[model samples]
Target chain A: MTTLLTDPATTGAHRADTTHPSVSPADAVRQTMTMAWRATLKMRRNGEQFFDVTIQPILFTAMFAFIFGGAIAGDVGSYLPLMIPGILAQTTLTACMATGVQLREDMDKGVFDRFKSLPIARIAPLAGPMVADLLRYGIAATLTFLMGLLMGYRPGGGVLGVIAGAVLAMIAGWSLAWVFAWVGTIGRSAQGVQGISMMIMFPLTFLSNAFVPVETLPGWLAAFVQVNPVSHVVSAIRDLANTGTLTAEVGWALAACAIVVAIFAPLSVAAFRRRM
Target chain B: MYAVTTSPTPPTTSAVRTEGLVKAFGGRRAVDGIDLEVFPGEIFGVLGPNGAGKTTVLRMLATLLAIDEGRAEIFGVDVRERPHVVRQLIGLTGQYASVDENLTATENLVLFGRLQGLRRADARGTAARLLDRFGLGDAASRPISQFSGGMRRRLDLAASLITRPPLIFLDEPTTGLDPRTRGQMWDTIRELVDDGATVLLTTQYLDEADQLADRIAVIDAGRKVAEGTPDELKSSVGDSSLHLLLADPTQLAAAAETVRRQLGGEPVLTPERGRITVPLERADRAADVLTALRTAGISLSSMSVQKPSLDEVFLALTGHDTHSETQETAA
Candidate 1:
């Protein structure tokens, strides 16, 4: 040990050579994928993280279909078409809330400090877990449709249309997740992010046409629901799942998603950079 | 004490160099203008109390925080302009254990290795080797939440070495560990330096700096107050003193006079107890003073050499106890 300390050549041999090239764009993508894998492993190890997407979808889909079916649509079968798409949109959006809550939790625990010191891309930590969350959204969407099928609702759009509807809902969920990610970066604690996300989510999902037709809402309440982006998403899913047709509503929903990513992606990255 | 001065040109072998580096929060400077230089394969210790800007300066050098003023360079790369490049040349184990508690020990190390640009198979291989080296092989698959503080700290240190960067920053690496664990951490640091990695370590424990640092800079209130080798700093406090407690209280005055004559200085006499202290001009003079006291018929109950402690050095330099202030400034 004494000789090792005194001999500069032997000791310096372990020093990393700085002449190696800088990280390439391809390496950034790989690092992001590694982070995504970590997020997926965490979700798998902790079964509780799955409760929202799995059990909540089954329980809410049945509860909403049974309690409101008769009064709103005359029968459970008739309401499934409307209710399935609504529940799908609602559950997927709720699942995205976890992205912000978990991000805040991870940040508070100081893991990001290590990430900031690494040569990886700045967006890897922010975007990687979000990529993994696409799976959670998919699970919730699938369960909601499965529950709809068990309630005697048959879709005229068939399997392909149902698959399309699920895909569109997941894309919307992914895009909306950026908003929560931004909140995660700015929030002080995980609980704070959870509270703020819940407050925003309840109003966005409940006030929209997810539960009932906007026409049935009171005039003053309908005004807000008409402009809610969630309502357009639900309408787009319904058009694809119930009628097997892609309409202007789908285009509107996609445009809303694109706009959200455009605005919040840069904002989330900026806020994250400032804090680090 | 070395005066604080800016170097016109840092040496080519320097692993790290900083000039007038400053970081402020809410209009108050957390790190006042500071200058430092650390050479390759050297263990440079930044000794200061909590909130003395030790961690803040390290953070800027590691590219974890933006430098508000002046310049910081790592291996000749400007940290602010090319942080990614700087990052590639260094690894940091922060003041806190920054590993993911939700992930197992192996998982955490592998994740770090992968992020450091190791191939998948190579990452796994490195994780296994590090786990074994750190004596954490048996608990490799267990989540960090179940590990003790020492285990978590070891894992944290292991994660930083995944890339074996030429320079490493350790921020209070043993702040909350038991004495035995701190000893282990010291050995690990020594091994890292022996392997040719230049280390810049910030610590509040004076003994830690004395044991590990090749050179130490004593900082207080965001400014460096002293910089020197440990022995140099100790000697600056003057030669060791010879303290004597006489068995016969009536012989105190005689013993004081005898010590003064032998040491050629005024001896401090305590009246409450028969105690006399005299500075020894040289350590060999201790034998002469003891024999002179015995010949004078002043029997002694206890007599020992009291070398100046780092605590006294810190007190003399900063005018405050080392552990008095607990509140730290934001970085």
Candidate 2:
């Protein structure tokens, strides 16, 4: 087998492991991880905002704490507990955009089409990009907590709540990737993906009471914020880190996670299947 | 993983068979209803001009695209019903280079090997051997983006070979390659065929089709126009061609008319080039032509009788030159 680089998909010998004569889910996961790892290693050379993964979350958390802390809540110290969770949600959500932008770039360069021809699982291409986005999520989550600590934002719920908050943010980032994957596949160009994704996400993030209390807004806007999934996620994290309590908002936020996975996971898989 | 299962084994017959396969995009039929059979182990060439649906046919056979209508079977397993099985038995390299540009040439091969479910050590070993076999061992560590077009193409082909399938589909594999690279690729193909792999290659280059194909199918307007061995197709056009180069430009028409009157058939003449061409069943007509031309006292620059080329056969069957833009538009 070493004498020539025969396509493994061609050999019937490998068919035993494939799921029912097609590509297996396990095989697809491995391929995606390999692709993600390759893309991850590339950051070592190209050096395009690798630090931003960690730096942006920290900067945003600190900057938002100082800017909005004193004016709205009377002092930075009093608002640090409240503002930290909101800042974490906002920064992690914003970091999700990178997945869409990178996917668009790869598609533009004909990289996805190459994946389509391989006999691996249909979902590997999505897996690779989605998995690669996790590192960004991890970096963002870590730096946010570090900066919150430096600025005197203590978690009332202790280390467990802090860990729970980070894990929640990471899971959200992973689930959100499916939505970006759908957008990247459907958009015509990488630039188009960035433009469309920004348009959709900007209002979702801004209108959902990330920076201020919903009670301060008009009656209709407050009602909208109450139902916003981002609001539930942020409030849940706030409950965990600030009050040391697992509130109903945490249940709603976990349900929202389930909903996002249900809707976007199939959407991403279907869109990918249609494309190949 | 064990190969033995309680289920009955699949029946093996023709390596690839298609019946009335049809595919349409946006109300335009790319591959009209066509039937083709590619037996195992021989190199089959699908010869056509641009937009003749050769690639579409190959794609359907490779299980990349679904058949809009009709049935396709690989090794007697229906493509739609058992596409994964078909994929397991065949290798496909599309028209463009499809390797990961960020990875080294060896990395690209190894990635595909792992995707094919090879163990890490085996995939790496296979990748190294393929890199050496394709003469890219020294360039193995360099990123694929740094490789030249020919080098990238070789790597793409090498990736497809990472698993030795019984059948291979190559869609215009040599289209943009230089003459030397194209020849090298042909040699590689010949070697694979000799090792008992069936290859179905689509090419517009008549010389390539002539050189490698055991049998050729000429498709026009998404249908097979002619199917035969290269020699058979050429011979079907006629025995030989009598080409005349006239000394005096004005005498070409006169010479053609004189030959037609004596031979009872019209001879094609080009007054601009002062040339005349006629088809002859026997070579003895060359002597008769000289006698007639001598009696007429028409001067001749050159004259010769030669066997027909695939280009001539394409012209004779299609009524237009294969290289002409109109033929491409027609398809």
Candidate 3:
């Protein structure tokens, strides 16, 4: 054993003088893409990851169209327009919660320990998964709209408008995911992150105008819903999908998304660095 | 091939140095205060029971945990002030495998290589070569979830070696592996040193330190209690001893007297087991004592020369068994 280990050819030949180069902006982007690619491969292999964006959107859209369509909007036909945008907003936002849950799971499993020791940019691991999750949001948004179309709902906004609505929803989801990513860094476990995220998301999506028109809700409850950022997102998607026109709500939603990214991106990175 | 560069640079002389290093969780100090100097091209073993702060010290050095107090430097790079540079000099394998179970072995290696700044094609080529070198070529495409404990560990070690960093930290690398696999890991570590890398290895197993470490530090309660070579440690405990169990209980006194006359030392006798034990000045003296006992018409059940076990050395230094303490901390 000693003779084998002492063989210089087997050992010294592999030794390369590794230089520590300062991480540039371009390197950071490449490293983030590497991590994002890993996340994408994981999502592909894990069938459960697709269950949310695929089955949940299809099921929720059908359940809302059949169960609450006539009672809320007088028929399924009119409800498709209302429910499609609402479900798109809800499904995409809900999908963001998985980002935190998976991050926490990765941390608990000690995967971040390897990343923490690496010389790459600190933000790559946190930001990479969020970038990959844009695909989940895209799937949820597209499926919700397709389910709406299957139910005979037509958007006057044309194909371009519906596509615009899906893109907007996906962007909103990506921004919201940063909040969950922050929670993931500080949370004790995946289950804990999921619990906390669900508590925050349930009220944000359910109580907003995503489900019902604000006027029909009680005045006090309706007031809170109108101010909810999720309501702005739902209203923006409704405008884009229903009328195919850019509206003021889209500006408010974009501002909200920008504000979220600006605040939580640094917060998440800070929390991540502290933990390391 | 890289020749053995004998640069007398100060940084190359010491791969790791820590002074008064301390880490605490809440109000409890996990690593009270540690002082370590691991020179280049040598394997330094930190031997301790679980929760004795071995992992804590390694984690701090690896820059995975912040140093609450004191200082740590890796090849002259301050771990706290310039962590990125320290990271470039070191590779760390945590107590856990730390590899992604969801990803295949190839993917995990490629991902680490890319993160370390290798181009995509270079990363893939490195991954393939490492997989082959580590004997994982056939299982390279399989997800780590399907791997056995030993395979996962090999992959984890291979992942850390992707960049061939000058310094490596392995925290209980063979803690959960079987003996055969642990032997393989020890060889791998020795091979690393042969390639001109310095290693700081933390282990709870005493034989592991004796087998691999050029020097060992025995730590308990987050402090170093003893530091020496394995031979120095064993000799410090006591001289080697000869132990004999008599086949006939009635001949115990006769056998003790013969051992005393021949070996010039009194034999401690245990009446219940009909056993006699005598410390020897030289290990070869055991043969002379055995012949004298037989000449006295004493029949023995068994006789053997025994050196002090690490458990005895640990007991002499810390007044407790390391194995039990490890179990307590694990519990």
Every candidate's fraction of true contacts kept comes to 0.43, 0.27, 0.39
Best by lDDT: 3
Candidate 2, pairs of clashing residues = A5-B161, A5-B162, A6-B161, A6-B162, A6-B163, A7-B161, A7-B162, A7-B163, A8-B163
Please give, for residues A8-105, the per-residue lDDT of candidate 3 as tens digits: 32222122222343577887899899999999999989989989899989999999999999999999999888889999988988899999999888
For residues A134-211, write the lDDT of model 1, one tens digit per residue.
999999989888888887879888998899899999999999999899999999889999999999899989999998
- Considering chain A alone, report the TM-score of candidate 3 relative to the true chain A: 0.91
Model 3 agreement with the true structure over B1-331: per-residue lDDT tens digits? 1123433344334688899999888877788888998977889999888778898899899888899999987776678997886777778988888899899999999999988778778889989998998899999999999999999889999998887777889989998899899899899999889888888999987778889999999888888999989878777778879999999989888888898898988889999899999998789988898788778889899989987776787788989977766332310
DockQ leader: 1
Clashes of each: 1, 9, 1
What does the interface RMSD come to for each candidate? 10.5, 5.4, 7.7
Winning model by TM-score: 3
The segments of candidate 1 whose C-alpha lies over 4 angstroms from its true place after superposition are A1-23, A217-227, B1-13, B240-266, B274-276, B280-307, B323-326
lDDT of 1 by residue, B130-183 (tens): 999999999999999999989988999999888777788999989999999999
* Residue pairs in candidate 1 whose N, alpha carbon or C atoms collide under 3 angstroms: A11-B196
lDDT of 2 by residue, A41-158 (tens): 6655566635656767777777887888888789998888777777777777777777877777776553454566666677777777678777777777778888988988778889
By lDDT, rank the candidates, best first: 3, 1, 2
DockQ-based CAPRI category assigned to the predicted complex of candidate 3 = acceptable
CAPRI tier of model 2? acceptable
Evaluated on chain B only, candidate 1 has a TM-score of 0.85
Specify the poorest-scoring 10-residue window by lDDT in model 1 chain B: B1-10
